[model samples]
Target: MSASTRSPKLRVATYNIRKSIGTDRRRRPERVLAVLRELDADVVAVQEVDRRFGDRSTALPPEVIAEETGYMPVRFGIRPESLGWHGNMLLVRRDTEVMSTQRIELPALEPRGAVLADLRVGGTAVRVIGMHLGLLGLWRKRQARAVLMCLEALEDPLPTVMMGDLNEWVMDGGCLKLFARHHHVAAPGPSFHSRRPMAALDRIITSLDLRVEAAGVHLSPKSRVASDHLPVWADIVPAGPTAAAERHHVAQSPLI
Candidate 1:
């Protein structure tokens, strides 16, 4: 098939719901669901969806997700009521086929981890990694490398995308640099401190085989108060032959 005739672009997004606790200190899962509906992304990487204590149950229940949004959580939770592994969850549109899923444990001072899913969206086959890295710079760097190693070990080389609350503050150094060495790191603008975002801690990174067409932080009245961090999204497509030739050139310039 020709480049123009390939599958339609896929919309991917990441959000840190802060365990459904908004800036007003209210645990409203419905408000988070409203923000997800606004994003309308084909694949969403969500962080802090579960409570930290007791059973670690999900703040945004699966039943609510299925009924409120056109997406379904990719089940990777060991606990029956949790929606993800270590508060990191991946949600794909209901029609998308989930071929396989894996829970990746990262090196961190805290309990940090990532979730990987191989999915078939429309006619395109892609791999999506959702994670929340540690707050410390050293641990973030190590976690970044660990996630890359996991990708390298995977047999199938699908157009890959990694998205989540990365927790790295600096725009050009540390974990961002480590990921930039192997992938096209994209900062879709500031999404932290949602009331007045000044930190681009949330991010979306894509492999060279994929081209990011459009990207930005989703800002709205509801988004600003739904969580402590806003949502970020990227529209991507498989890089055609011509795009593949310019991969190196684009890789040098991170923001897309």
Candidate 2:
């Protein structure tokens, strides 16, 4: 697909797997993988990944997920606790090259954090950040603040694409504003309380600098039982340098 000067077309999504347990008293790997395949995201930020339980890392989470869905694992950051490796992960198309990646530990009741990955996709630099915040109210408030701090601390002002299981439920909340300054695209809809979704809890917001080429909430019958909350996502086409320069010229040049 040809990318325009303003935005490069891409498909991305976020999903929160509820520990892979579904209606069947079993963690059906096929079902889990199937749900993801349906979403069809070129890049994804997944939360609640179980790496190791009692001395064994999930032998093939990356490989299996990749093999089934074709999205390659770029980076995985396990939580501080060692018993079971529970944490966040970023996956991209196998063809995509990883430029850099890191874990961002935030202040909260639990050891919550985020993963910021710099990737080169088809000759374009895409900054992808995947984060899961605290569930508790007080802890979540603090965690939200910390999330804003991460955006403020970015090394470059280039357009950013963030995803993951952001624990916030309120649509008009302050956290949205923090992302707003960066130009998050309009939310597709809410994606929480999946058993019987009440409010649009799960969200897919993006930097205003990017365009919402496509967006949606995943709520398959299996996805609901797999996780308490549904996964929301957005396909973003970042504002390229050509567009940025034009905007700068508009800012500096007077009306003719």
- Candidate of highest lDDT: 1
Residue lDDT tens for model 1, 10-92? 99999999999999999999999999999999899999988888999999999989899988999888999898899999998
Taking the tens digit of each residue's C-alpha lDDT, what string does model 2 give over 37-59? 77767677777665334543442
Model 1 lDDT, full chain set? 0.90
Model 1, runs deviating above 4 Å: 1-7, 242-256
Q: What are the models' TM-scores?
A: 0.93, 0.80
Superposed Cα deviation of residue 28, candidate 2 (Å): 1.8
- Best by TM-score, which number? 1
Where model 2 places Cα greater than 4 Å from the true spot, the runs are 1-7, 23-25, 51-56, 78-86, 221-225, 239-256
